[model samples]
Target: MTNENTAATALILGATGGIGGAIGAALRRRGWTVKALARDPAQAAAGWQNGPSPLWIAGDAMNEADVVAAAAGTSVIVHAVNPPGYRNWDRLVLPMIGNSLAAARAAGGARIILPGTVYNFEAGTTTVVDSTTPQSARSRKGAIRTEMERLLEEAAPDVPSLILRAGDFFGPGIRQSWFAQTMVTPGAPVRRIVNPAIGAGHSWAYLPDLAETFARLIEKPDRLDAFERLQFEGHVDASGTEMIEAVRAAVGRDIPVRAFPWWLMRCLAPFGGFPREVVEVEPYWRHPMRLDNRRLQRLLGNEPHTPLDTAVRHTLEALGCLDQRGTLSQAA
Candidate 1:
């Protein structure tokens, strides 16, 4: 697509979320006419504003009329909507997928870009997961994600759709993510396992990079026609020791890094947002999995990735972990 065509009208679902807001901003920066879709129009407009901002469409992603109205006259649709917790999956994911498909079809075959995750792969599969990795139907979350993909494929067989999957997200405005506010908060019961010897190597995706990649995919929707899956290599793949070092550098001092007991994590699973499915995936933290993005690089050409220090700094600042002197502290 030419520079002029890159600015085609695009609609993003779940625009109030961190990744969605970032993608919206990136698209607007690239000159795309962006529209943000949400369940509450007023709340979306208030939370998702970036300068002049995109059109805000308030409606449920599962509602046919709402989806239709949101997708109208749009050339691209980003299905970024997701349920708040695992318990809401059965009630939400399928319906949202169906609604998104309906909207895409109604919009006369607009490109549909859906955010995906590494959970689709089975446990103990050590290879760098790429487009062709066989999805395991073992875990509950994995099964749910696989089923969602199947529904999307069936719903829009002709319309172009892209699935960009990445590792756990950690960046600005990502309070609910596993590594960000969920684990790092001060005075919160949760804490990071700081043993460099044991917790040093883990893979995490930066939100800014993920957002930029999604924007690029929307700009070159045709490139997605030939491929069904894309994996993004995130900012850094380091051990827990390296992660702590990065955090210290970002915060400009050493901070306590204590691992939460597995027993406590299990105990809190019921009340906390953390589910049993998430605990099952904790092996990824101990053994980092590499996500090869050779195809993404080949397609998008030398895209800039956020540096480790810079990403850490941004994340800490977003979480209010930095003081005026650039020292790490608890959020007020």
Candidate 2:
């Protein structure tokens, strides 16, 4: 397949997910031709498919033919595919990585951008982390991520790729996030697990901010070499108490937070969905993990972060938390 056009195109895998959807929207706003690939096209968010849309391709990232077709005529490929659950990793991560690398190679040197996480870091690290921070493969998830990076690096000899690692995400439409249905609901059973008095400084990445960062990187693909890793410290060093307070202020209510009991989580780990691997990483929630973003700030030139209150409010609104009257009346 060939094209006679000169305009750039970006193919985003996993476009229905939180980060991928945001990145797709950002790219579309930037006037790039955005092609989104997902397993089920019907599952994609509303209004993302209608009208003069960026091409929506239905495909699985693990399928070579699907990926190859999706990559055709694209200048950049964003690898955003993730397994549905923690237990699926042992079966899914490697194949997906391999297929993505193959698709990028087949695309005739398109820049491959991967959204990464802090799972590669270890416990008890005081120094702020950057691209050069020593990765400790201490946990199962961390080791899997490290191995994925290694695979990308090994394939870098023939493919141009970049990995941008950000912190835990919190933004609109993120129901599964730590602060979503778990912590923000009033009189909910899940609220008891999200104590804000733990005094841990955790990183939280807002989806829109990360999406904009990825859009900027896409515009300047030449800056990426055979392989590069970047750290985007979205928001830094905010304690759990401060975060909870900010959220409460945003929503105009006093939300309660209780400490997450590791013992209870361990007990529940035997269940299929809540695997032991999820409980094994509980230390991250209990300790501080700081990220250094000097490079990201320097590259992006002092973009203002989303204020905590505004971010929290926006998240709540997206979750329909603000539609109280209608929801309450319906329940009644």
Candidate 3:
């Protein structure tokens, strides 16, 4: 348990990213002292819109010494950093998390809050997943994700950790998301959107809502275990048409929906890049797996939720798809 001196102090490793920035802002609004560790603090400050500006600490997530130094006197460490452009994640992901675990231990039992994904579960898992779901994913990224949680479990008791696992992210300031990357193009009008649904269903998490959930759980450490995994039930698109419909509603018109080109991605897999990665995890889209939030509800009473249209509209606006004059009307 953190002492009175460290209770309100939080150190974020990826404050420029969506979930991290949101959590940093939420904590600051709650009167907690927040610090963000970045290689260039100035660059991070320019794009920071999570809640409020945090005290910038010059450091790198890959460097254990840097993370340990920045985590000093902090009761919480948000390890949300990842390799840019999904490049070098195999080489950089574990080591960076290693540093966070080390720093968390050095901070005297500080809780390390990890922004988790559904990647830990097998891509073909059709069952509704909860914290108790078995992690049997076989893809390269999935294996890496599993190992990261294992490291966290190994560090438990000494360095308490919480894995708040959720679906793919969609919100402002998100750089690495399937929503912005594949479903809709950023910095331009969304003429058409590709539905990720493939006969099954999918889940979408609003970053702001997920981050608010993190802050709520973090504020009540007594409710957390030394190592806890909570599945967040976000927007569960059961029929696989909800997201596309939401986009249409946000645009105030019936937009044409395109099917995701799985075969093209399969053909491009031989070239070795995002296509290869996508193909490797194709089973995720081929199956339905909804995250169960019973445990989360027990702790927080209710999960933070935003209306589908409102979330899509905000995301589209942030992604520069819609302008001030081109936004949706009240009756739309």
Clash number for each model: 7, 1, 1
Residue 189, candidate 2: Cα error in Å is: 14
Candidate 3 residues lying further than 4 Å off, grouped into runs, are 1-7, 323-328
- Cα lDDT tens digits, model 1, 82-152, are 87553577568888877887888899987778888877777566556887778874766778888877776
Candidate scoring better on TM-score of 1 and 3: 3
Clashing pairs in 1: 199-240, 200-239, 200-240, 200-241, 201-238, 201-239, 201-240
Better of 2 and 3 by lDDT: 3
What is the per-residue lDDT of model 2 for residues 1-115, given as tens digits with 9 covering 90 to 100? 1222338798988776777777777787777788988777666645463224557788888788899889998878888877764347777988888888888888887777888
> C-alpha displacement of 87 in model 1, angstroms?
5.2
In angstroms, what RMSD does candidate 1 have relative to the true structure?
A: 3.7
Alpha carbon lDDT of each predicted model? 0.72, 0.72, 0.85
Please provide TM-scores, in order, for all candidate models, with all chains considered together.
Answer: 0.88, 0.87, 0.94
Best by TM-score: 3
* TM-score pick, better of 1 and 2: 1
Candidate 3 residue-wise lDDT, 93-212, digit = tens: 999999998898888988999988888888664468887788988888889999999999999989999999888899888857889988888998878888767865688899889988
Off by over 4 Å in 1: 1-3, 84-87, 155-157, 186-201, 267-277, 327-332
Off by over 4 Å in 2: 1-6, 45-53, 84-87, 185-193, 270-272, 323-332
